[model samples]
Target: MSFRNLAAAFALTCVAVPALAQTPAPATTAHSASDMGLKMADTATVKLKFVTVKPADITSSKLIGTNVYNNNKETVGEIEDLVIENGKTVTGVIVSVGGFLGLGERYVVLDPSTISVSNKDNKWAAYVDTDKDTLNKAPTFDYSKKK
Candidate 1:
């Protein structure tokens, strides 16, 4: 009722008003199933059919040590490691090229689609369309630097 009291109350209200205004509003649904005419299922209940390869067809361990050859049937490199994307798809293969008995070896990354596999003389062989010289010229990949 007093002027001093009224002034004090007005100051307090001014400070309180901004804080209240700054408070975040409750989240609202941006989209609804009825709006799209499609019922949404829980992500946990959703089943995604991911692509898969048979274990008998090719195993990781078998591929690791497999020697890669060129069209000339000359050994170009050995598959040192496989680059997997999203922990499922095989994206690339790291081949150790231009080295003798693992000494001074340089690693080259090649896409999995670029390589082919064959069974000949009772042995499974991996082949690439590139030659040894071409693969040797590719930029080297350092496995030790991977984070």
Candidate 2:
């Protein structure tokens, strides 16, 4: 296992979990460390189970415009659009952040893997893992492939 995975394993072990995490996380469908870093694999080697929370479940559901926060609770960007790659998995999230009132709304791509369902009170929130500057510095994508 790589250092990142080792650290994650250690961190997870350190946490007060009610149960132990299944070994190798049952072969996650999400991208592996190699894929996340190198963008090597475009398809999953395993099937993972997940439940998609509906739009109504999001706390910012009816807001029309809601901000996305990072793991540290810092505003990363506003979720203006969503993009899925390869006709299946959600790959990139188009965020419109910074600038004043749409004058300079930048289209930044937040990796889908970096996001998780923010378990808010009776609702869901999209939380990205990286901070604002790091988010802004991420690579841009050509989102012509609309799925």
Candidate 3:
């Protein structure tokens, strides 16, 4: 009985001693947006204004990638992107010109008012008053240098 009791005590010591001796893993920390070096903008700082869209109002989805044409119905460029200032006004429209299958493509920023868009027969088209040659020779807009 004494030997049996000693053996039981030995078993408990062998199991508990190793467990007590082992160091616990470090606590996992929950990372917030700030911790990852991202500064989140406060939505409360921006005043929200509700806007009502009319049926004639064009959506961005329909405007972007729309083929641009001249008054002669010649293809001048394609609308690539839009530049918005203060999240309110669209300042410029980015048009890709002089590209052959996107190989020699160059971007040009045009005034929003200069380009007119129309949706006739469910086909969206943008018209600019410039020719294809003029747009191809215009000053290029480099996307890599955008701040």
Best by lDDT: 3
The runs of at least 3 residues in candidate 3 whose Cα sits more than 4 Å from the true structure, single-residue gaps closed, are 1-40, 46-49, 144-147
Candidates sorted by lDDT, best first? 3, 1, 2
**The 10-residue segment with the lowest total lDDT in model 3:** 31-40
lDDT of 3 by residue, 1-147 (tens): 343333332332222332333233247844333322112366544233223344655556676679999999988888877665433346677888887887788999999879788889999999999888899889999864233
| Angstrom error at residue 137, model 2 | 2.4
Poorly placed runs, candidate 2 (over 4 Å):
1-65, 141-147
lDDT pick, better of 2 and 3: 3
Q: Is candidate 1 or candidate 2 better by TM-score?
A: 1
* lDDT, model 2: 0.50
Best by TM-score: 3
Compared with the true structure, what per-residue lDDT tens digits does model 1 show for residues 74-140? Answer: 9999877766543234567888898788788889899878989776675777999888889878998
What global local distance difference test value does model 3 have?
Answer: 0.65
lDDT of 1 at 52: 29
What's the best-to-worst order under TM-score?
3, 1, 2
Task: Provide backbone clash counts, one per model.
Answer: 0, 0, 0
Candidate 1 TM-score, C-alpha based: 0.59
